[model samples]
Target chain A: MANVRLSSIKKSFGKTDVLHGISLDVASGEFISLLGASGCGKTTLLRIVAGLESVTAGGVEIEGVDVTRLPPEKRDIAMMFQSYALLPHLSVSENVRFPLRMRGIGSREEQAEKVAAALETVQLDHLADRRPRQLSGGQQQRVALARAIVSRPKVLLLDEPLSNLDARLREDMQVELIEIHQRLGLTTIFVTHDQEEALSLSDRIVLLNGGKIEQEGTPAEIYSQPETGFASNFIGSANLLPAEIIDGETGPVAKFSDGQTLQLALEVSARGPVTIALRQEDLSLDANGDGPKAKVRTRVFLGARNRYVLGLAGEPLRALTANDVEFSAGQSVGLSIDPQRIRVLPR
Target chain B: MNDRTESLLLALPGLLLLVLAFFMPIGQMLILSVSGPDGVTLSHFVRFLSDPFYLGILWRTVRLSLVITIICAAIGFPLAYIMARVGPKLRLWLVVMVILPLMTSVVVRTFGWMVLLSRSGMIPEMLRDMGLVGRSFALMQTEAAIVIGMVQVLLPFMTLSILGVITRIDGRLEEAARTMGCSFLQSFRTVVLPLALPGIVAGSLLCFTLSASSFVTPNLLGGTRIQVLAASIYKSVTQTPDWPFAAAQAVILFAGILLVLVPYIKMTGPKDG
Candidate 1:
């Protein structure tokens, strides 16, 4: 494992800039995720790290060696594509042994041993003789994983490798990934738009937005303390409600467009117009209590829980509450949340 | 109608056309190849096989065709790869350029090669000016002239076949190969070449058969001194007016092509099957 440092990497496609000067330093053996939606250039950043793409401006350093001009093969890195990208002509074992064969890692006998070990790691030893086309989608992905880690390169790059798998397989693969990362401790950069995958897998998440680094932190840190309006809305999909904050008796009061007022945390220093981010689970439905008056638009039953979509102050707000507390559509319900749970951001 | 009978009915016209337009003439040719004045005889086949002149013509035909096919494959593969990877507009232009020779008359194309390849022409004169060849070196009416003319005529078949296959190959596979520590050429050799084997096989088969039996270009370019089996067959029918002997030479050419193809097909055919 080795440290990967990307210094103010800027990439432009002809004229439109894809990645604005973004600098990130990843320590050795750390799992970092570049998380963003489609067209957000997260995959581009990963490709840049893998040397599959050229940087328009910044420098890329690995293990204190500047490799900005090097090709992917010259760089000691392995990448797993989202499409699996297995060679259909080769058998599973041969596919896994490709990097070793290309790099001339060891003698033929040693390469065979490593191939066997990799196939076993993916629990695909029995299918070693089978071609890539003979395997299922999940099995092919496992073979790709085996092929990537077979040579044990200095850094590993994954471009949404789990996005293609079904939900159940994705979870299983996520667990497997965590176990493997723990065992091998390879410095890995994983690019994915799935928030849960990044939160569950990475030591740190670098959230990308419009080709720039929007937020970067540990899962809990970024999840619990989102400073920007975009961050709060993107992560956990927090509801952003436009309101004007004024000094109240105990704390700041947020006055909604419908003249509904809700108390904010005492530590909230913003005293002007701001957007307050309220988590779906934080907002509670009250029948008689004095809170923001919200009209119950719809209730979606999600087995153990009910998602109540409510219209509060001419804006849609969702509440995730227990199935036991039932609310019908068209009912006027009071929306309640703790004063401290309100996160105020500039409008 | 059931699926099988309906399918057969739909294929009936093509089957009838193949038998009438293709197979029946081949049958007539086969009968003519063995016919003598008295009755069915092996005399024509025997005379041709015993004569060293006819054997030399056959040998030269096989050798020149093989060279032309190999050269076409070597040039076609890289050209097809470039055409496959280029932008669509440029790829269309390259396709048009590769196929433009086929669109013209074969006699016209051969005459075009003849102009540039003659002793006093641009190619030989340029080579002499550059001191690449002796003053006595001449290109006209040679085996090489026939090969060059045939290669230009047959290259499109090889290139177009390979391009169709390469176009369908996922671009990501090469990228994956690169990440697996393969250089660009290594990736091409290991990943792209193996996958494109079917196309190469198809293209080589086409180039071999077409170059082997082609009459106009080889006859005009090589002239009478250096003659292939087809040119020899043309001479037998037209000059000597020996219809049976010409048919016999044609049969030999057909059999020889099959002889080369059968072993090649067996070598590259499906392993398990």
Candidate 2:
């Protein structure tokens, strides 16, 4: 395993700048995730690291080698494409042996052994002789994974590899990925838009938005303490309400545009107009609780929990509550949340 | 009518056209090839097979067709690949350029080749000036002339066939290969070429069949002495007026093309099925 350093990496498609001088240093054996929505340049950043895309003006140093101008084949890295991109002409065993064969990793016998071992790792040894088209989607994905790890390159880059799998398979693959990472200890850079996947898999999450790093932190730190409104909103789908922080009788209260007031932490330094991010799961819905009142607009049944979309001060607010709670449309419910959970940000 | 009968009715016009226009002539040719004054005989087939001159013409046709097909594939595969990879607008222009010869009359195109390939023509004169050949060098009335003329006419068929398949291949496969430690050329060889085999095979079949059966280009370019099977067949029908022998040669040519095609079809057909 080796550390990957991308210094001041800038990329542009003609005049439209996609990545605006982003720099990152990943530790050896660390699993770093580049997380963002579609068209947010997360995939582009991952491609740049993989040497699949040329950097406009930056240096890419893998294991301090400064391979900025090197082509992808010259770089000691393996990438699993989002589509799996398995060579359809090759059988599963041949597909898994491709990187080792191309990289000249070992003798023929050694390559075959490594291929068998990699297939075993993904629990796909029985299907080694079958072509990629003969395999199921999940099985194809596993073959892709086996091919990627077979050579054991310095870095493994996965571009939303689990996105195509169904929910159960994705979860299973995610667990398998964690186990593989733990066992192999390969320095991996995973690009994904799914927040939960990034949070669950990565040692560090680098959140990207509009070609720039929005936030970078541990999953818990990012989840519990998102620094920006975008961060809070993106991470936990928090309800961002435009409000004013003013002195109240009890503590600092967030006064909404329509004069609805919600309690904030007493240590909140922002005085005037600010946007407060309230996580959906952090808020409680009640009929007559002593808190800010909101009219329930819609209720969605989500098995164990019910998500309520409420209107507070002429703005949509979402809150997750227990399945036992039942609130109908136009029902006025008290929205109670811990003052500490309110993340106050500058508007 | 029932659904099956209604569908058959819908297809009746095409079936009638196929029977009247296509199969009728072939049936007539087969009948004429075996017909004799006394009875059905193998005399025509025996006469053509026994004669080395007629056999040489057959061999020349098959050999030249193989050569032309190989050359077309050698040039067409890369051309198709470039056309497939380029922008759609550019690809359209390239395709039009490749197919422009086909838009003209085959006789006219062959005459164009004749002009450039004759003794004092532009190509021969240039080669003579460059000292690449003897003083009396001429490209006209040679197998080389026939190949050059035929390749120009048949390249579009080969190129477009391969282009249809190559364009459908996911470009990500090449990129994935590159990431898996393949160089650019290695990626093309290992990934693109193998996936494009069906198109290449299809194009080869078309090129081979067309070159083998083509009479106008070879007759015009290769002249009377260097005879291909099609030219000899034409000579037999028109000059000597030996209808049965001409039909026999035609059947032989048809059989040879089918002989080459069957194995190829079998190779590619089952994998897809």
On lDDT, the candidate that comes out on top is: 2
Full-model lDDT for every candidate? 0.92, 0.94
DockQ of each: 0.72, 0.81
- Best by TM-score, which number? 2
Candidate 2 lDDT over A1-347, as tens digits, reads 34999899999999999999899999999999999989889999989988899999999999999988999999999999989999998899999999998989999999999999999999999999999999999999999999999999899999999999999999999999999999999999999999999999999999999999999999999999998998999998999999999999988999998888999888987899999999999999879997888999999999999999999998999999899999889999888898998899889
Kindly report which residue stretches of model 2 are placed more than 4 angstroms away from their true locations once superposed: none
- Estimate the TM-score of every prediction: 0.97, 0.98
Model 2 lDDT tens row, B90-161: 998999999998899998898899999999899999999999999978899999999999999999999999
Clashing pairs in 1: none
Cα lDDT tens digits, model 1, B1-273, are 899999999999999999999999889989999999999999999999999999999989889988999999999999999999999999999999999998999989999999999989899999999999999998889988998899999999999999999999999999999988899999999999998888888899889999889899988889889899998999999899999999999999999999888977986788741
